[model samples]
Target: MKLEPHYLKYLAETQDKDYILLDLMANYGNDVWNFAYFLTRSSDAADDLSQDVFLSVYDRIYSFRGECTMKSWILTITRNKSLNYLKKQLIRKILPVKTVPHGGTVQSAESQLFDRMETKRIWSAVIQLPRKFREVVILDAHYGLTDKEIAELLNISQGTVKSRLHRARTKITVILETDNEGE
Candidate 1:
């Protein structure tokens, strides 16, 4: 089996744990973090979840049979881990959890506030959607993953991805419009 060149740089299924980890971080760290953040909408949770994902990946590496691309598999693990994290959060249910932004800004100050508010509004609307719809919206709309790629990452059919995306978009539109009516 010809190894994917991208995977070759970071993983070979024959390397030591450290090398595997280094490769995973070097190649997919941001993606894992982004995936986690989009799902949890909590940067801190995303950081923790990203680490958990890699740990799980290391523990489960041997089980990977190359049934899918390495990234897809890693993302699948991240998705599962995020879901688990969400479940744990629900159980641990405590005081309000706040997601603080770290730093940096590219837009002008005036536009930044509006942009942030708009982004927050959209995110709030997205969060209100069902989990399946939310995931599809983030993966396809925010992360720019293709429907086929999302299907593979989500372990769902492409048609399902398409349908969910459509439903999500419709719900989001209605949500934003309803909010506008109030304002």
Candidate 2:
């Protein structure tokens, strides 16, 4: 999900805590949960982490100075929560999961099945990346966050983000090539 351009302004102008939070949740809930799932690879953990993220947002609303977009703020919270959950659980394993790209046009059954398999294969390679690399790739490719945004969210320099993204793409290419050779 993409960030609405006026969301930060809307959030700032709103005075009622409940209304602001509900609006945030309505706008960003799926994005938050999906990011959590990408990090943890567990639906259950994503559910818990998303809840905690919203709770933190509610508690820390006053702290938001609008330095960043509202989506960035919410996603930063989600990333921190997911990482903390991973650390606490000692879970570094990433299970492969299919995330089919969204498309509208209908396709033949054979074409659809092939697309699903290809998407799954690509996602499988992605999840196999190290946490640092995987997070950058997902943030860039899936969430469409720019290098500066990702650096801010991940607490790394823009150069580091670029390096990681480059390395991650190289690794993914090698992996897919290997898979094709094996097949």
Candidate 3:
């Protein structure tokens, strides 16, 4: 019988303990946080969701069968947690709110202006997409996951992923064009 790699053997050996799991969480913390932030668009919510995702990963790590990279597996968990958080917020009518303080000077006003404009353009287009299409766009564009990876993560067919991505791109383009027409 051939032996597995040292890391996999180590992982399998220590997979049951909380500290080892904490190490995994620490290693992947930033990746998970960034993914959540991209999905939620709120720093506070993203932070909380990242923690929830790590908890879920810790609980479910034993179920990992090495079919996908650990990072992909963790991302799948993060995506699910983010969507669940969004759904709960909608149910509670606690949608994310951004507040600007009065009389506060923003450093680099010109850059801030550019950022605001770009964000408006991008989010306006994205917001027009239906949930299924928007999710694929977010996961692919923001998180840089391949279509096959997304299909596995989403448990959907590759054709479905491609279709949704195509629809999302067309919707975004239409929204941008309409905005340009108004301008």
Candidate 4:
């Protein structure tokens, strides 16, 4: 796979730690926060996790080896941080909190309402999935990561990523179908 142009720039500018950190945050801050929010389903946790991920990146920037795209590497850190945050919450036996989805201004009211409802329904099904399935689904569908990138990010085989994505989609289909039947 080809490396991101910014990744090459990032590699070349590692000496200017502030510039690298700022550039990384400017480029990937949204991706990191969104991934964290999707994983934890909490804006507050996402915020905290985003901060932690960036700080970790800031501290460990030198350790980057270019084995993957810089975005993939950053997202890998995000995934790891999110999982750890969830684990700690689990260990504490604290219930996870839900976050409100953001709204858009451009669409007509009815169109926006229907769009929100559909998006909520689909995400509800996705949220109910097992973590492994959820991870692959969010990585593949939300982030549009290639199977190879996801496999590398999650440290799974490419076939496993494909399998999990298939199963996730199938489970989501079943869930939506059941919901429709009820309606």
Candidate 5:
């Protein structure tokens, strides 16, 4: 699934960098988008953040030391960008900003509404986790990365990834259970 190192170097050095970038987008766009969405929890923000990740990759990929897979490198960019986006959002909330009016989301089927509500509740629970736990949970549950891979990506031990995942799941269960009891 991973391309060779020489090919990654070519992408960094080639004159046809735009073409190479487009090809990279075709391969990794979904992963970038999903990672952004998982972190930001906003489709619009995720779209912008995903584009920013590609832009950052295009500009700085030559600096990639090949310490990890290209996917991890780009995803690290995404994670950083999403965190930056969240910080900006927090600042905006702290300081009132002139906001533009946007249309609301369209309604779907009743079943879809129920599913969306459930998903929203779960995500809210997930978002409440400590940053370490949330990151491991998202990388594992959303991206299907192995604990070993996550440990490498996170620069932590595999045991840490496993334990954090367990804690995150347990926390989410308690949160949802408490919510259900309240309802």
Candidate 6:
């Protein structure tokens, strides 16, 4: 997407202003939400996280140095927010292992059923991976982010991203193939 000069000027010069920040959020909101959804595996959680990311972006817009595109910056925020949310969920699950309720009661019954059938089989396999590997898989396969972009967002080396992604794909592939054999 070509950045309009006026937009660039506004971002570069007046990004601290609320209206400019709101404009940026409006333009990139859907993209951020999609990225968050791909990471979270829940549309409702993605919606909440996307809103949080945009709020963070709005507050931090003036800190942008144009080192990367606005999309990348926004995606970085989305990734961080999603990761934080995942960590919180994991902690909650771990802490309440005995107390947490487990049953077949789902608020979105229709959507849950559809999700079970239509969900990417590979993603279910991917989730079985350790967190680091799962992250690489989600960023690469699910979100279509390049290794360089993933590295930039995750603040890691490109080689690390490549290795993790390779390992993740192999693990997920094995899981899927094994499941297929059992079925």
* TM-scores of the models, in the order given: 0.75, 0.90, 0.70, 0.86, 0.71, 0.69
RMSD of 2: 2.4
Q: What is the lDDT of residue 138 in candidate 4?
A: 85
Give the better candidate number (2 or 6) by TM-score.
Answer: 2
Residue 97, model 2: Cα distance from true site in angstroms: 0.6
Residue clash pairs of candidate 3? none
- Best candidate (score: lDDT): 2
Model 4 lDDT tens row, 87-167:
888632223333335655688889877777888788888888888998899888777889999999999999999999999
lDDT against the true structure, per candidate, is: 0.77, 0.88, 0.73, 0.85, 0.76, 0.71
**Which runs in model 6 stand beyond 4 Å of their true positions?**
1-7, 13-23, 91-119
lDDT of 1 by residue, 1-183 (tens): 223555554456466767777878888898889778767767788899888989988888667677666777888888998888888886322222223233565778887777667777887787777789989987776666778878988888999999999999999999999999999
Residue pairs clashing in model 2 are none
Q: lDDT score, residue 76, model 1?
A: 86
Give lDDT for model 2.
0.88
Clash number by candidate, in order: 0, 0, 0, 0, 0, 0
lDDT-wise, the better of 2 and 3 is 2
How well does candidate 2 match the true structure in TM-score terms? 0.90
Report the C-alpha lDDT of model 3 over 1-183, residue by residue, as the tens digit.
Answer: 112244356567774557757767777798788677656666888899888887787677667677776777888888888888878785322233232222446759897776667666776577556668877887787667788888999999999999999988988988898888999
Q: Native-vs-model 6 lDDT?
A: 0.71
What are the per-residue Cα lDDT tens digits for candidate 5 across 40-143? 66778879998999998889766777767777778878888888898888522111111222245665679566766676677678767767788898898767
Instruction: TM-score winner between 2 and 5, please give it.
Output: 2
lDDT of 6 by residue, 1-183 (tens): 323456568877763577876787788887787667656666778789988987787787667777666777788888888888987875222110111122575659787655555354655576567767877776776456777878888899999999998888788889988988998
**Candidate 5 deviant stretches above 4 angstroms:** 1-14, 88-120
